[model samples]
Target chain A: MKFSARNVFRGKVKSLKKGPVNSEVTIEMPGGLEMVATVTTQSAENMGLAEGAETTALIKATQVMLVSE
Target chain B: MKFSARNVFRGKVKSLKKGPVNSEVTIEMPGGLEMVATVTTQSAENMGLAEGAETTALIKATQVMLVSE
Candidate 1:
């Protein structure tokens, strides 16, 4: 599916940490890059996310911040 | 400054497109990976973003989504 998010990394679910309100998901992408995402617990369950699952991490351009250093 | 965002990429500004409310900033990072970010025009101006400027793109874990494909 095509979306507006500019950053999309295809990866495998490396870990899952479920919390009351939010769940932390870590995806292991190519080149050893890991992307972490936090989603609502409800959404996490709805998606049936589990470790070793293949998923794509999406990040909207607007959500990205430019930090000058 | 240290931030909570899990994804931090250092790159040079390759291009900038300004709109009424937002500006599209394209950063070219190592390995030829290009990341695009949309920021408020005000913030873009405040940051003085331009071509060839070095900046770090930050994306929080909460702002990311995982999609199964």
Candidate 2:
């Protein structure tokens, strides 16, 4: 399943916050901005994603539909 | 930016193939097993995805790892 999203940023996994059914993964960009993504523990392990690991964050800018204050 | 894939199948956009940089979205599954995605016709009219609408195909199945002939 290859999705065609723009490779917004490539960064290193800065932290992994555990959650009930999912985990919050934060990637630290070169410019210092952070992008947070949510993935299942299963996915995290399967992707071998962990703090300090290199990864790219693909984002369908449009899918980012909204943001709330 | 949210990415917590695993929605697997919930299709409708039955065809829209036109590629160069990217564009090859085909989603049609109802136990029928057909999942192919590759978007960008400006993301098919900014997610106004044609051909019957109703979208949902988030797959992180180990990134579909690999495939060969």
Candidate 3:
């Protein structure tokens, strides 16, 4: 999909944990790097998300924050 | 900081584009990989974020996705 967000990563859904309002999703990339995302419970169901399903991890650079030690 | 979500990348601030409400920030990782993020104007200024500054791009795996062709 054509998206304005610059970071679009390919990953497979490794696991899913549902909560009252939000769901925790883990996607592991080809490089073996893992990322975790939090989405609303409704959104997860709407996406028909399931374990082992291939999906795109869309991260808006704007949502990224910089921290220095 | 100890963050619950995974995928914390180290990078340098490449540029910043400010809008009325949101600001676009670009960070370049060590391998020359570039990632972009969007933040609020207030948050950007509050953080005193500027170009050429070192920062951490925090991405939750949940924010990431996988897509197949």
Top DockQ hit:
1
TM-score of chain A of 2: 0.79
iRMSD in angstroms, per model: 1.6, 6.6, 3.3
Per-residue accuracy of model 2 over A1-69 as CA lDDT, tens digit each: 234465567799999987766788999999899999888876677677778988878786446676689
Stretches > 4 Å off in candidate 2: A1-3, A66-69, B1-4, B7-24, B27-32, B36-38, B42-69
Across residues B1-69, which tens digit of lDDT does each residue of candidate 1 receive? 788898888889999999999999999877676789999999999999999999999989989988885
lDDT of each model, Cα atoms only? Answer: 0.89, 0.74, 0.77
Tens digit of per-residue lDDT, candidate 1, span A17-56: 9999999999987766678899999988988899999999
Q: Which ten residues in a row have the lowest lDDT in candidate 3 chain A?
A: A60-69
lDDT of 3 by residue, A1-69 (tens): 597768877778899899999888887766566678888888788888889888877776656665665
The 10 consecutive residues of candidate 1 chain B with the worst lDDT sum are: B27-36
Winner on lDDT between 1 and 2 is 1
lDDT of 1 at B9: 80
CA lDDT, candidate 3, residue B32 = 69
Query: Which residue pairs collide in model 2, if any?
Result: none
lDDT of 3 by residue, B1-69 (tens): 697557787878899899999998888776566778888888788888898888888876556544444
Q: In angstroms, how far off is B52's CA in candidate 2?
A: 22
How would you class the docking of model 2?
A: incorrect
